[model samples]
Target: TYITFPIYSGITFNNISSYVGIQAGIAASGKRDNTITTSINGIASSENQLGNLSILLPDFGIRAGLILKLSNKLNLHAKYYQGLINIFDKETSLSDFTWRTQQFTVGIRFSIRNTNDCGTCPAWRT
Candidate 1:
C-alpha cells in the first residue's frame, strides 16, 4: 500500500514546502526446525519432520510519512515502513514470529531540463 500528500504552489511548481506519502513492499523467508536440533542418539529428527520441504509465501505491509520540495522539479522525501512477514510451509509453523521491522528512508527527485532562470537562454530576445 502507498499514500502521498500533494503540496501545490501557485508558482507553477515553483517552490514547495512539504508533502506526505506512502508505499508498500513485500518479502518472505522460510520456517523450519534447526537441523542441529537433535533427538536421541544425536539424530536430527527435524529432517524427518519434513517441515514444508519447500516454501513460497507472500505478506502485506504499509508505509507512511512526509517530504519537502527544495526547488521546482527537485525535492526530498522521508517515510516510515512497517511490514508483517510470515514464513510458513505446509507442515512448518514456528512458534517464534515477528511483528514488524521499523525503518526510515530519505530520497530525492529531479529533472534534466536546463533552468532558464540561470541566464543560460539565448540573449538575442532581450
Candidate 2:
C-alpha cells in the first residue's frame, strides 16, 4: 500500500479542463507471494509463501489528466501516472533490470457546492 501526495496545476476552457502534477509517495506496508512448482517424473506439486519484498520507502512520479465538466457540480476524468523511481531493492535481488509503475484511471467526480460559492471560486472570478 502507498500514501501519495499530489500537487497539480490546471487550466479550464469552456467545459474542458486539463491538469499536470507531480506526486510524492511512500509505501506503508508491502509483501509479495512467491510460488514454487516442482515436477518429479509424472507428478507435480506447488507451494506458495508470503515473502518479504523490500520496497524503497519513498517514491516520485508524474501525472497528467483531463477533466470534462458536465455541469457545475459534476465531471468526468481520466489520468495517467508514471513512476520515476525504481521501488525494487537492487541490493537484495540479483536481477539486472529495474521496476517502475504505470497507472491509468478513468472516473466520475461529484461535488456539493453552488455556482456562486466564494471560498471555492478562483481569484479572477471573485
Candidate 3:
C-alpha cells in the first residue's frame, strides 16, 4: 500500500516534510499431504489412506507503513494490511480456499481556524 499527506492551512503551502510512506502485504497458499498405497511383502496394495493436512495459515504477521506531512496544517498518509483466510472445513471433501486483501487510504488536510487570525490585524485600531 501507498499514501500521501497534504496540509492546507491559512492558505499557505509549506515545504514537504515526511509526506510520503509505503507499505507491503504478502500471502501464501496452503499445502496438503496425500499418501499413496502401501507395499506389503514385495506386493503393492491398491488400498491406500489419504494424508492429512494442517489448517491454512495466513501471512499478515507483519504490517508495515509510513506517514508524511505535506504542509503545516495538512497531512497525507496511506497503509496496507493483508492476511490469508481459509474458507473450507477439514471434514469437507472440497479443497481449502484462501482469500486475502487489506488496505486503506487518506489524503488532504484542512484547517477550521479563522482566516483573519493570520492576516493583517483588525484595521482602524486606534
TM-score of 3: 0.31
lDDT of 1 by residue, 27-125 (tens): 433335545455788765554343322332443445555556666567677766555454233345443544444568888978554443546556534
Error at 88, model 2, angstroms? 1.4
- Candidate 1, pairs of clashing residues: 2-22, 3-22, 4-21, 5-20
lDDT of each: 0.48, 0.86, 0.42
For model 2 the local lDDT of residue 99 reads 81
Q: Positional deviation of 55 in candidate 2, in angstroms?
A: 2.2
Give the Å shift of residue 54 in candidate 3: 18
lDDT at position 40, candidate 3: 84
Name the best candidate (by TM-score): 2
Q: Order the candidate numbers by TM-score, best to worst.
A: 2, 1, 3
TM-score of each: 0.41, 0.78, 0.31
Q: Model 2 TM-score? A: 0.78
